[model samples]
Target: MLRFASLGSGSKGNATLIESGVNDKDTRILLDCGFSTKEVEGRLEKLGRTAESLTAIVITHEHSDHVSGAGRLSRKYNIPVWLTVGTSHACRDNDFYETHFINSHADFEIEALNLHPFPVPHDAREPCQFVFSDGASRLGVVTDLGYYTPHIISHLDKLDSLLLECNYDERMLLNGTYPHSLKKRVHGDKGHLDNKHASELLKKLDLNQLKNIVGMHVSEKNNTEEYASNALCEGLGCEQNAVSLASQAEGFSWREM
Candidate 1:
């Protein structure tokens, strides 16, 4: 069996726990460690797990909200960290227990889980998203990206599950109180994915085997769960309940494939 869960997701912090295999030999991997070590431990406990149970921590980039506790967690638990060369340079200060440099276009394995990292356009040091598989089931996680590109669409073709970003609503973003510069940055091509853009991208993907669709990294100041769900539902031609939202406080529970 293959299953995944999110500890939390937002601009403040983000972490995902993915497990592959069953019984005593399951392999667990944390996709990102954006929160403090103590906070992460608490969240892991919520899922009935501990930091020591993780086999590896895979970082998408060097952004503070994505890598803040990765080094500390790995060091404390003696877990290896996998990231790109650029991300390594950007996080030179963090002391990792073991570091494995991964290529953006390469496929790597962590026990029963297979990971494929693909580059994305984000304002960070070589940021990328991932597609994971446990031989039979595929799960794609695409977040913290600016605009959707053809390459991204191609990479996310068919999957058993998808966690896609629906960062903001254009109307709320334009009418909100954020400074002009910050607003521009948030809506820029190298910023985050707005609801409409995310919806359009979903419409172009192949979702024949899709069992779940999650809207993630929503902007608290500029987006609403209703809007995000409605947008993605429109694209998928499904009900609002079909697409779940990952929140800042209580991340969604585990879903299996």
Candidate 2:
């Protein structure tokens, strides 16, 4: 079976563990490493994983929130780290990882997981989210994008599980305590996704095969789990309980697909 779990996900940090294996041999790939090595290990332990379980570390971008611990963890564990060329250059200067530059638009297979990385619009060096499959089921991770594009929607079509971003509530961020400049940046084209945009994206997608849609990367200051879950469910015409929420503190438990 194929499954995934987030170590933690938010502005503070983010990391996802996607594992595929049968019987005994398993291939585990970490999607990002925003926390320190110790913290990542601790979270992994909670999820019944360890550093030795990883086959590789695949990065989404050079942003600290997504890559803070990637270099250190990969180097210490002697794990291959995959990223876009731009992201490698951006992180190479820091001297953290042994890098493998993968084409953002290409499809590749690593053991049981078929990985497809597509470009995303965000204020980072070559940011791209992923869609992973193991023949029977597909899981999409589409966070940190400012807005949904036709390419992204098309790529995620017929996914079994999705870790989609719902970063903020428009009204909450606009009228919250943050400064005007900060708010503008958060709402900019290269910034985070809001609830309305997320809802619209969900409405436009084909979710017939989607079993678990986790609302991820929610802002502590501007977004709440209830609000995001309700909005997504409303858009999908499903019950609110049908959608799950991943918070900054613990994220969510391992979900099977």
Per-model CA lDDT versus the true structure: 0.91, 0.88
The all-Cα superposition gives candidate 1 an RMSD in Å to the true structure of: 1.0
Clashes of 1: 0
Runs off by more than 4 Å, candidate 2: 92-97
For 162-231, candidate 2 gives per-residue lDDT tens digits of 9999999999999899999989888999889898999999888898989889998999999888889988
Candidate 2: global Cα-lDDT?
Answer: 0.88
| Per-prediction TM-score to the true structure, in the order listed | 0.98, 0.96
lDDT at 7 for candidate 2? 88
Mind sharing the TM-score for model 1?
Answer: 0.98
Strongest candidate by lDDT: 1
* TM-score between model 2 and native: 0.96
Q: Write the per-residue lDDT of candidate 1 for residues 80-156, one digit (tens) a residue.
A: 99998889899854579999989999999999999999999988888889999989989999879889889999999
